[model samples]
Target: MPLAGGAVALVVTLTLWLSNMSRVPYEDALPTVGAVLALVGLAVLALRLVAGGWARAGLMSGVAAVYILYLPVAVFAVSPSAWMRGGLLLMGGVAAVLAARRIPREAPGVLAVNRKINLILVPIVIGIAGVVLLRQIDLERHRPAPDQAFAAFDGEASATSPDVWHLIFDRYGNNATLGGAYGYDNSAFLSALRKRGFAVNEEAFSNYQRTGHSVASTLNASYLDRLSSSAQAADWVPIYRSLTSSQALRFFERQGYETVFAGSWWNPTRRSGLADRNINYRAVPELGRLVLGQSAIGFALAQTGLAYGDGRGDQCRRATYKFEQLRELADEGSRKYVFAHFLVPHPPFVLNADGSCRSLAKATASSRRDNYVAQIEYANREALRLIDAILAGPRPAVIVLHSDEGPWPEPFVGDERFLGRDPVAVDWAGLNARQLAEKMGILMAIRHVDGAPAPAPASPINVYPQIINAYFSGKGVEPAPRHYVFESDAALYRFKDVTRELN
Candidate 1:
């Protein structure tokens, strides 16, 4: 009974944090759990001074116990009907209150058993926390030096610098995958790019299935063979570390060019310590969004205007801000290398086709393919404008535009009914070739100055190397072997190359 509140709180927080280890940071739950446990412990202590031990215990544990009881019913929010979810909330709250009331009157033997359970729980939670902390402590300690493939040239440049803009169209699918899986043709968009002097790849696919692996591979110009194939829970810490301080960025920084990074809501693409200017919008924290914000209580908070993810308003703002920055920076005539990651044409489908933000109500009810195509249309239209503005600028220009990975399968990010469920729950191993392609496909194109042919990579691993070979004077690295690998969400580091299957 003495440890019940704090024990349950720690265990619950630990569960949420562990299941989302790849997405959530190691410290995400520590402070919240500590503050909550302390608050409840102090309340119990104060109440015990004036009241009976049983009364104090029940009062102090009420909120913590409510959340525990609420977990089972949290799945109720998945139903499309709002009334069903609201009813579950009301009934769950009532049940929690009644349980608290009954706790004070429990028999001695029952209270003793409850205390025993808590005794076991508290130690187990602490041990788990201790084991995970050591690995995460040195996540950012690695500062990757330039690869020997890229080491030949001292990073020196700046003759009108031919300002470079690398843009990421998150979840933008390639032509075949868009048409084959979703029945959405993108030929006109490719034709549009051709007119803008871009050599578009109709069959481009990501080298990895997930964003972290794909991005780290692309930015570093190599595969994640360094990561163990049987990587465990804490493995993502280093992936994130490698992502922010990539070998590619180091090479850019050496060229005497200013590095500008614009980020979005997703964690891997959220920030970069190496960039001279990191552009990001005010959005809900990644931990809160991926963990608590997807909960039933988070749904309630959003309904009552207490939550921050309003129609992905911050994503719309961030993406719009990136386009605006591109317009100004392209025209500013400065020597620069800009990496702008736009999380759009992606999920939640909140950004409308006509450059407007859709209401959360409509976004929740949207058909998956229709809204995805809508966002792609919006990206196509705006990108043309940005390209035109850049081409007219005083300095020579280069644009490397591509998607990190393709559209997520509908089961992972459908309407509100599916949004709260974990992507790991989907059977990635069971996916057919087309479905795999749907997830692996991407939009890729490159442009260089003077109407010269851009040397596009077979996959993302060769992207930076090709860029270096075309522009730099020294002997550049050979393109790394191209292979598209997918791993189960359960084992993020384990690899199974599906290159032939996708072909």
Candidate 2:
């Protein structure tokens, strides 16, 4: 019984841990429930082990039921670590042993077989019904209705434009490094946008930290408080669904832009389905392997989740595929808003064109600097490619290229230095600016591309508003104040000095 209980407990703990790693809430509760249930299950398992009776089959059946339920759920929450998978397999062994022990006490072999069948069938039916309902609800909310054409991105504004390119090179740091390290000034990239008459907003800072938060906020134009509150809700599914159904799509579609989404590897179900057209890195064989591998592993372990090789070595190459993807969209003669989200500078640092990370990862701080510089350079080059394609085509286009948020600080990139931790309440009892900045305003850049960059001290919150105003809403159609400069909480950052450069 103890063994059976332990197995159950182990399964629950793995689920909880995986959920935590995946940033899912309820990490604490699941384990508590599992622990209690495990104890109960364990007692039954133990009795059969000792009595050498029909209890063995019952134990095996229960263990199987627990895993069949737990493993799939874990996959949705987090990628299964090697440990979680092994733990599940181990439970199967425990069940088999308990079942074998029951063979001896059976009054009739037929009756024992029938009981075993019933135990398995009951749980299986319940599980199937639950999964079906959950999936149905998920689809109803997120999936587009058959009558709707993927949020209609090609309305009026898309009518006479050349080609619109929204090149979002994920976290590609700025100009100086691009020029010195990549041996090419990112000016080449900027020059291309300028030639296309894009009045770039050179000083654009992303409103939020991290991709999920940043991207979610960008599309929905909602502040972190709302997003965080949503995240903390009873279910995250609604949050994901809400963002999917944002009014931004309808707005963009009304602007006459045919939006197409392209990315190396991400669950397109979230972003792609919302766009008019979605292309994945899976279209190319080499990139397809990485996409499929991640998907397969994710499917197997129920974990789905990027790599930008660190440094200057192959940053250009890293951006190449995305640039090409954007160019293809531009060539389609559709006034398009192509979201080319490149997964660079993320981690595991393996996808380098120059294969530099092999030697660089072992290097010290200075070497790490060189590696990051290399990545920045590559990012710049890719930016240039997309910009050139747009400039070459005839069109009155506005290019807005910016980071999702700030990079990590120090020996690592985007560390606490960039993202100040949420303050402990007592710490703020008497703290002021110095303390606040230490915990909040990590220097983040919102550098823009064409137009006269908006006065600094801009809010990442208003990025969407600014873009819409610049591209679609026209000058007089001022967005709400919250859109321009919202705070992490629902508070607002007052407009201050416009001349200050991001420190």
Clashes per candidate (backbone, < 3 Å): 1, 35
Write one digit per residue (lDDT tens) for candidate 1, span 157-177.
Answer: 545346677888878888887
Per-residue accuracy of model 2 over 169-240 as CA lDDT, tens digit each: 555544433333334345655655555444444434444334554555555555434433223222333333
Model 1 scores a C-alpha lDDT of 0.67
Q: Which candidate number maximizes lDDT?
A: 1
Which residue ranges in model 2 land beyond 4 Å of their true spot? Answer: 1-121, 124-163, 174-203, 222-243, 264-270, 282-321, 353-367, 394-396, 411-503
